[model samples]
Target chain A: MEALVASAIGLLTAVGIYMMLRLRTFPVILGLTFLSYGVNLFLFTSGRLTVNAAPIIGRTEPYADPLPQALVLTAIVISFGMTAVLMIMAIGGHLEAGHDKVNMSDTDDDTPEVQS
Target chain B: MLTAAWLVDVAASAVTGDAVTVKITHWHGLEAAALWMSLAAIGGGLMALGAYPRLRALWDATPRPEAKAIFDGIIEPLAAACRRLTDGVHNASFSRAVTVAVLAIAGAGVWAFSGGTHLAGDRALLPVTPTVLALWAVMVIAALALPFYHRDRVVALVLTGVVGLLIAPLFALFSAPDLALTQISVEVVTILLMLLALNFLPKATPVESAPGRRFGDVAVAGIAGAGIGWLAYAMMTRQPAFDPISHFHLAQSKPGAGGTNAVNTIIVDFRGYDTFGEIIVLGIAALVIFALSETLLRSPTVTRRLGAIAPVREDGDRHPMMLVVATRFLLPMAMMVGVYIYLRGHNLPGGGFVAGLVFAIAYLMQYMASGYVWSHARQRYDHHALIGWGVLVSVLAGVGAWAFGLPFLTSGFEYVNLWPLEEFELATAAIFDLGVFLCVLGAVLLALASLSRLGLRTGEDVNTRAFDINPDAAQAEEVR
Candidate 1:
């Protein structure tokens, strides 16, 4: 069961990394979403391969590692924030520079002197 | 109980054996797998059902927007501008609404934090202190920012800077000391630079007109803020899995490397290569700024006195006596505190980050208490030289470590045997600390000086040649 889950994660990671290498903003966003899923699944599966255990420890039951789950939840939110920031910056840059290209090529003459 | 269950499984295993030989079947939990598969199928089926009409109408119904492109291009930017202006004008009432919303959200957040702890069994969710504290801070900041936003633009800008400054503590809370220090210093310098830059811009004004259309701004802001709050709350309920760097810290901290501070140990020893790259990036950034300084300044859009501000005469009056005196008294105290922070950083809550910023504020208060003219006259260092020296010092430290047959940031200590005192470890780590300190102080002042010298529009007209030529040249520049 562990092997299977590991293999699944590996596959997802490979695909996600590949997509991340793409030059376009849209695909990069999609890639990030995919990568996040892979990461969350990988993280969730680290608590040993349990069939019946949900890690939601009740009054009369043994407990699972709840910390990893908590962390994964945070990763989800932070990733969302990052995605939002990335999207906004991308869109704003595209509009201002009049190009949706990933490279900052079009603003050769028009680029604001970015400060240190 | 767990052992009992295992014993029961063993007993069942023995009962099925002829010679006590029991075999677990392959795909034993295949039924559970089937249930999961069915769930996936159901979700896929729902998606297909929803997507079918969209697939059919992809070309026919999804043509470009029916409105004229020109109409949209004109309206969108104008509308966005109008909205921003309207929000700025009606900021007082909007801020009140925000304050209320933030309070309610924070209250709910506290309830959630308590509920999370309560709902947990033996392996209950850990009470995440930082997340809770961060939430509280956000709400507090939101509430506090509103008054300043309504009253004064400078105060609003400072409030924004405070929010950025708070990012350092958040980073520090997460145990990323280097990141925290860098972030705090950068935030301070940037804010100072901003204030100086705004010396050319219009003074902040109260909304003379009736503040209306505020409901739209309030609703939008509330929704956004609420969404963020809930998202952070949901995330706080998650778990921690791994620390990939712990092994390196433990294994290589002593024999492989040398340092008691595990974080600094890792940063200077293991990831020294990354530090080198970052410094290179800093160098490049500085170079870029120098390169673009001319054209960026010369840009047609950067004309002085472009926005018609209510002009003040050259005879600048001092602010109320109490403010000046109060700030004057605070300056020396602040400077001493900054020095203390810088000196005592290695042991306690104080650090180079806070110290450098405290120093900047001390400088800032000098200008505030005294006139800008008086402060400018008392300027000590050549701002350009300070910047160059700071960067050079940081680079030299990195290179110095490299020269010792170690990596770029090889941090270690050599004991100095003095005549009167026992030998002590003068850790090279302190050099990095010093470099950071100098960079922060110098860069901050440089940015302030550069921007403050932009235009003489305020009651801050200098007794310089540019002051005479500027009104006419700047007026012509504004026209063009």
Candidate 2:
């Protein structure tokens, strides 16, 4: 099961990367969303799989790893910030350049490609 | 397993000692187990769906923007008015450097004077507190009065370094060596990055503003830093009552979950969920960086040449062949040490956190020595992919445990005969460690990469800022 979930995450990441390398902005964003999902899933798994147990010992039979859950709550919150920042950047770029092009050299010189 | 103390007492009716009863009878059986399993799956699935990544994105980016906005509005008027008062500092680089130098000196002075800190235990230094207050007062006064008098950039970096370097002592005094090492490394990277950033900004303009206002500003800043610092110092020294977590750690160190390594036990068993969540945060940070890089992060044709940064100091070849060669020599040794630290983390102070940082620093050194061209050429994995892979591996570890009719992140298993070396105990724990390592590595790498790339963009944000700063002036400049 761990292998399955991990493999899924890998597949998502691979897809995300492929999209990330593409020239369009929206697919890149979609790819990022996929990647973040993969990441969160991965971290949640790190506590190692357990069943029928919450982290609160007496709340159930076997206690689950509460720390990972708590950490995940915060992660969810932080990811929202990241998403917003990304969206804002995306919108900002569209506004500036009038096109949602990935690796646009007009504003951000990220591609590092020599300008024509 | 189902019997309580009283029930067991009645059942046996023989022994009468304070034998520890686990109260196993208040038990949740397989049905309850199924419920929790389903719930975790749901939650994990939602995150995987990226249904609400924006929730955290808001929190992390703005840090409670409403409160900040309120504070800023109130402060802005005063700050604007206060700006008229200039600390008579001429050389901006010198002054900034001096500020950093003063802080570094303070760190050194604290160590030199205190001679390795003892747990003060309610011992308050009121007189020296006043001196600290006075120094802070002086800091403000100097900031205000000598606005025109600038010092070296190195001094400013050191001063900034001093502000946070005290954490190293506190970390050491508390016996958290792993944290101490990470903290110090973080500080080094931060200051270096800050210096690198300063390269792109226009040098600080000479202080030619008002004298009375300068005095007022200095006096205010001094009082503020002093008061804040002293208050924090006092609070730390006071030894606050009601430490629930420490008590919890002590109580749980050797019970129910059954792990002797207190930190590991605490993090994985007691609070594994929290660690899980933090790694998720790391994963998110990586995703966000990746996302951000693709769009609003382009640079100009000339700026492409800027990624090959001039080494730390531009004045001379301070990073000589020997140092470069030495870093090359040490790479393998550092990696080995990182592995050692990572492997022994469950039993010792060294763990994924420190080990990850060690490896990262080693990589950074390589980047510094041979430059990004050579270093990046060897990249086998897309940083984005690495981030995702790291997170997935951690989760998959937990999922495996779930499949076994146990709990997530549960540790301490006996070695079963799997070709005679099937230690689920060690393997499961190691997987978690690797997850942490990847998150840390990805996070620091992305942040620094972003910062470095900032220098490469000469006209970055300048287009936006110039347009905003003065539309008329920008339009005039745009014509040229």
Candidate 3:
């Protein structure tokens, strides 16, 4: 299970970074979302994975660390906020510059700035 | 319980300006620090407020025309020259540049892998179960393939959702039901938000990147993936170096906080400051989105694009009959579920965050099924006010603890025996959770509502359709 989770996290991070590096803003944003998921999962494993153990207190059963859970919860919500902000920025950038291309060519003379 | 009482007593004494009987320690010093911090904050706020308007008026009212022209003359040409320079630099066959970059990064990753001393003696005691491995293998493949194949944004969106759903089950398997619940609901909302945004965005990513750039991206991504994967495997196989503080939360949850759900207790009671910050971030994010959408809607350039992208209006009917009818029946039941989830959060798998999301989802359903215009006409609740009230309630709850000389968010519980019913436990945590529930609900609704408002603002006559599954059928009926 641990090995599986680790590899999953890696794969997510790789995919996330690759997408983010795409020339378009949408893909970049998608890549960011993916990266956040991988980070959250990685942070979560810091608590050490426990299967079917006690979540809350009852008898004397072991519990998965609640602190990391709380931290991940915070991260998840914060990431959502961040994603919203990024999406708006992307939309605004697209609006102002026209075309969702993240990178702009040097000379405006080469390609006329087209609106819509 | 005794420690909690002591801590509260110390805080109370400090608040009342009385000498605390507790021994002087590093922790007790925080009371003094809190006082100084508050005083300093007040001073800074007043100074900024007093100085801001005067400074703003001075800058705006007085402008040197020659200085402005001189500055623009120098800066404009310089900026253009620099742009041209950079463009020339990047114009060289980008493919060759990217291949070299990819090779360099890949070589570095290989070198690091071979030289790594961290995992030298460590090995797994037991082999991973085949089922878990298989699930992970599938997830890994999907994750890797998504970005590579993501020409269409919708397919990528769906793929992301699939990954989220897969991860949520892992959370559940790890005995973190609260996380699982929150993750799943958040996933749904996220996918919905993406879908809404995609409505205005281009259907496919424009193929503009050079092949070299794509290859470089892959190399970088591969390196990151490999590094994190190795770290995860290493950490999982070894015992933690230090004692986990989670032990304190798990042990103290029931006795000190009077809640079985340690995660809930930690969020609302033990480490409520984190929750407070989290909610504020959420509220701020929503407000920013709301503000941006309003600005974007007003901008002529964006308005033009929005006009062009107006989804094809096949039918005259804005709101479909079936969806409206279905949502009308489902709305109240969903709200009830939200309430139930919120109330039971302290002791169960549900909590304010998830419950708030549930409520927001329910409200959003109404907007989707009836269109923003219909909902606005019948019921008007200012989403801005909702967000403000939610934040205010939580902040007040935190400050309420200070009134009793207790630390912020130090919840107190009392068992009450009412006339007809059996005794029940009432914890201040519930009030705190209420604040959380409100904030989550408000933030989600307000942000999405702002997007819906943007859709309506487009000068087009298409009354925003409430969920039309088959617009062709509606068009045929109208023709008949």
Candidate 4:
């Protein structure tokens, strides 16, 4: 199970990096999503895997590590907000630059910066 | 380090009876696993390089007969499936061949890796279960295949949701119900947000990068995947080099914070500072999204582009009356569930984060079903204010502790007798959780609301409420 999880993390990271390195913004956003998943899972595995362990009090079995779970919970919510931001940014970029391509040329000064 | 030791000693003294078992051992199998990962990555990279010439030739072949045939083969069945799905609600059937292919691929990958991972002298602290192992294998395969299976933005977004579903169950199986609840709810909101964002993006991802560049990306990706896999495997299978702080949290939770749920206690009490920072980040992210949406709405370049590619709408399909009526009934029920989850969070699986997402989702459903114009007319509350006020409430919760000569977010509780009931317990943690609940609800809804503005162009009501005609005038108005 541990091997399987590790491989899963690796797979997600690999795919995420590959997609992120793609020229388009959508896949890049996906790649970031994949990376975040890999990171969360990695953090989760830091607390040794346990089956049917107590999460709260008054259970006979030992508890799985709660600290990592708490951290992952925060990470998950934060990532969702960030992903929304990224999606908006992707749409805005496509509209302004006439394409979804990431990594714009600095020499191409046509893109307008958002002023508050 | 000294403080950590002192704290550990304090916790150890507090917990009576059983001695803490500490294992210090060298996990020799990690070296072998690392070797396997490096070898696999390097081999995959080399294979991609070797396959580059043949792949490029196939991609560049005259008339593209093979590629065209493959494309037609996939699209014909897919189009048929889509048409069938549209014809009736009960006619939706997934392709059996695709399902078989997905299973076969995942099975082969898992089987191949499992053989290499059973090296002697290095084993995971917990015994591996077949169920978990199988789920992990399937999840890994799905993650790997996602980029290739869907070039359409909407399909990819849906596929991401599937991937999230796959992970949420794993959290549940690992005995982390709070994490599972949070994961599932966050997944729903993320997918919904993406669906809303999809309206502004091009439908399909065009083939833009050269084959050689693509091969290079695959190579880099393979190395990163392998490296991370090896590190995670090594870390999980071995005893930690340092003392785990989880024991301290487990010991302190009930006695120190009057909460049975250790994870909740950590978030609301022990590590309240981290949660505070996290909520602030969420608020900022939502605010940034709102600002960007406003920028896009105001930009002439974007509006011109939107005019060219935006979907043309037919009558009656814009907002289904049935969905609106259903949402009217469901909204109050969902709000009830959210409140129920928030109130019992300290002792149960549900908490502020999940409850907030629940409430946000409920509100979003109304926007979806009734259209933004109708929904906005009814609600009449600024999402910006919701976010600001939520953060303020939480910050105040933390600062409230300082008034009582306690550290920040030090939750204080007491048991009091109420008429017609047993002793009722009230804790300051509930107030902190309320703050968390509000912030999460506000931030998520604010971000989605901002994105929903882009979708308003398709509504029956054309927005003709522009205050300024000229660019500088609009800019000055925005400043005001």
Pick by TM-score: which candidate is best? 3
Give the CA lDDT, 0 to 100, for residue B192 in model 4.
Answer: 86
What does the lDDT read for residue B162 in candidate 3? 84
lDDT of 4 by residue, B88-124 (tens): 5332222222223334554565566567654342654
**DockQ (CA atoms), all models:** 0.02, 0.03, 0.45, 0.32
lDDT for each candidate structure: 0.48, 0.50, 0.79, 0.79
Off by over 4 Å in 3: A108-112, B1-131, B313-319, B459-480
Single-chain TM-score of chain A, each candidate: 0.76, 0.79, 0.89, 0.89
- DockQ ranking from best to worst? 3, 4, 2, 1
lDDT of 3 by residue, A1-116 (tens): 67778888888888887887777778878888898899999999888788777467884487888888988877877787788777777777776667777655545534536754
Which regions of candidate 2 fall more than 4 Å away from where they truly are? A1-116, B1-152, B162-166, B203-240, B254-261, B286-319, B415-427, B452-480
lDDT of 4 by residue, A1-116 (tens): 77777888888888877777766778788878888888888898888677788469877558988999999999999999889999999989887877766754445555654422
- Model 3 C-alpha lDDT per residue in residues B1-480, reported as the tens digit of each score: 134657767787989888666543435465678778888999999998899989899989996578888999999999999998876667544334434554576578668857975544253444566666766877777786797679988888888888877787878877788888888888887877777777666669977768876776677778878888887778888777678888889889988988888889999989988898888889989999999998998888787777666565678655777878899899999989988988888887788999999988888788877887767666666777777777888888878889899887778898899989998889888888888888888888777777777676455554444554557787899999
TM-scores for chain B, listed for all candidates: 0.53, 0.56, 0.71, 0.68
Compared with the true structure, the alpha-carbon lDDT of candidate 2 equals: 0.50
Encode model 2's per-residue lDDT on B1-480: one tens digit a residue.
535577765555546555544344464676788778888999998886795677667757874448878899999988866674442232223223333443565466455646854445463322323433443444333322222222233444344355334433333332334434555555555554445444532223223325664454344334333432333343334343443243464346446344444455555555666777776776676566545544444534224333333434454443355656789899999899889988766544455666766777778777666544456667676666666766787787777788788788764445356665654344466677687777666665655455445443433221112112344777899998
True-vs-predicted CA distance for residue B135, candidate 2, Å: 16
Please state the error at residue B410 of candidate 3 in Å: 1.8
Each candidate structure's count of clashing pairs: 10, 82, 1, 0
